[model samples]
Target: MKRHITGLFVLSALLTIMACKKSVEVLTPSGSDETYKVPQGNNDYDNTIVDYYNKYGTYMLYKFTEKDVYWTPTGWKKPTLPNGTWTTGAEVEASDSAYINAQLNLIKNKWFGFYTDKFLKKFLPAKIMLCKKVDSVFTNYVFTPTFTAVKGTKKVAAFYNYDNIQVNYGDATVNSMTAAEQRLFIYKVNLIFMQSIYARGLNAPTAEFANSADYNTAMTTYAQAYGKGIIIGYSNITAQSDWNAFITAMVTYSAPQLNASVAITDQTAAGILNTTKDPSGQIKRRYNMVRNYFINEYGVDLQLVGNATRGL
Candidate 1:
């Protein structure tokens, strides 16, 4: 997927932009603290984001103008400072509202609705920018897909670029992506959330599935069947990579998909990779660990969520 594990150095500065190099009160596009009603619509992305703002308030990053903004899920378009150096918004046009809302609704249902509903936590990013175009920010949009506020005690921000990916349908979202695109998108999202501060509470299993003999066998079978790309790949060496790998397992790969992906050379290999045949008695140890974490910590069942998301 042309991906890497650590994105901290790349996107953390995004939060700085959200803070405007200093903390500012939650200012609406009008740059006023007065009550700005969240725009109402059937769009899940807009509604969920508005709901977030209603409860917690949104910090206006930039009063952007020029480029088409992706609404609230990405970043500021062309932010200017207060001293006439620049200003925040370009002024919202009533005519474009319908089209913008349509695109945003597609994005929300495709990928973000999952987070709004499944990411049950209080430590959400204070600022969210759904950029109108990829180049609206200081850096190139390709390298910055989803930036989240996750570093230090400072404020947090999450951004999405609308032009980052291509689509055939007039309506596009996570569901509209190709099989491979969907997988990569899900993987990236998992990594983004997994590396965030909210995911810091996740503790890798030490005993439940860590018996030396059993782990050794699992690793051996995994490597032998999958040829080392599945478990211990390039993006899985970081401190949180293990958890990332686990999330990838739970969300991206189902039990049957995993078992079938294995190259069955022998009964032992087959047994180790197969949940029905595993002698360790845990068909999907990695998946089980992650599933338990969500259920135990967030009261959300990963199996149901995964199945629904993956169309399992």
Candidate 2:
């Protein structure tokens, strides 16, 4: 009996040792994990991306998969059309390596050159996915006048020709863009930057502008709204709506253009000039307020950025 009890104690000790060893092995971290690793290459393009990452804390991804583009919680999935057809939703192809240098130069000259280092560091998105093409296809169903189905057809929509900051550079190379395209490119980049400012609630309108009765009235037409210090009509009158309208005005017109419009006395209709011109001095007041906010808060003039995009 004494020998048996001693053997049992030894067995229990061995089991405990085995369990502890298993726990240690399970808890150990792998040194080769690439989950958070930043990709690097010896080429100049890769080096440029690394430099941007180091400087602005932004990842300029040129070579990435479709999953990188659809990175929301739901993630990438094949879409089922209304006609009961399973279709590939959106395709985000990797950018052509040959245009990397030209693309980088365009970004540097048109985008980064417009904003100060401080502003870009603060507001730039963490990840910028550069791609050659982003396209989507949908089923186009035709219906007869009597509500009968005629036929269903698939239509392809190409979005590579435009410059979208959301997708970075599309297939349209910098050299291939026409004069109009370049202007649009500048305008879009500037517009996205302004949108980022609004999203962050940075440089927002003051209480005086946001809460003023003159600026928040319900109007039937654009002219009526302009007279009341409002630039555009709003279905929902809230602080957020007011800010959106103000931002729309900022992106739509430059300082010189606004000033020119405000000075116009000639009217296309009685008591009203063209929609682009503001006669009541109300729009001017709001413009100055918005323009001053950016200058004072960010030490950057939004009008200058606007004027630059306007090709002034």
Q: Considering every candidate listed, which one attains the maximal TM-score?
A: 2
lDDT score of residue 48 within candidate 2? 83
Relative to the true structure, candidate 2 reaches a TM of 0.66
The C-alpha lDDT values of all candidates are: 0.40, 0.58
Per-model root-mean-square deviation over C-alphas: 17.8, 9.1
lDDT tens digits by residue: candidate 2, 218-260 = 6666556667666545345565556566655555455555555
User: Tens-digit lDDT track for model 1 on 97-156?
Assistant: 334444445445544555544353343343333432222122112225565322121111
| Cα lDDT, model 1, residue 263 | 39
lDDT of 2 at 211: 59
Colliding pairs, model 2: none
Off by over 4 Å in 2: 1-39, 73-91, 135-172, 196-204, 212-218, 252-277
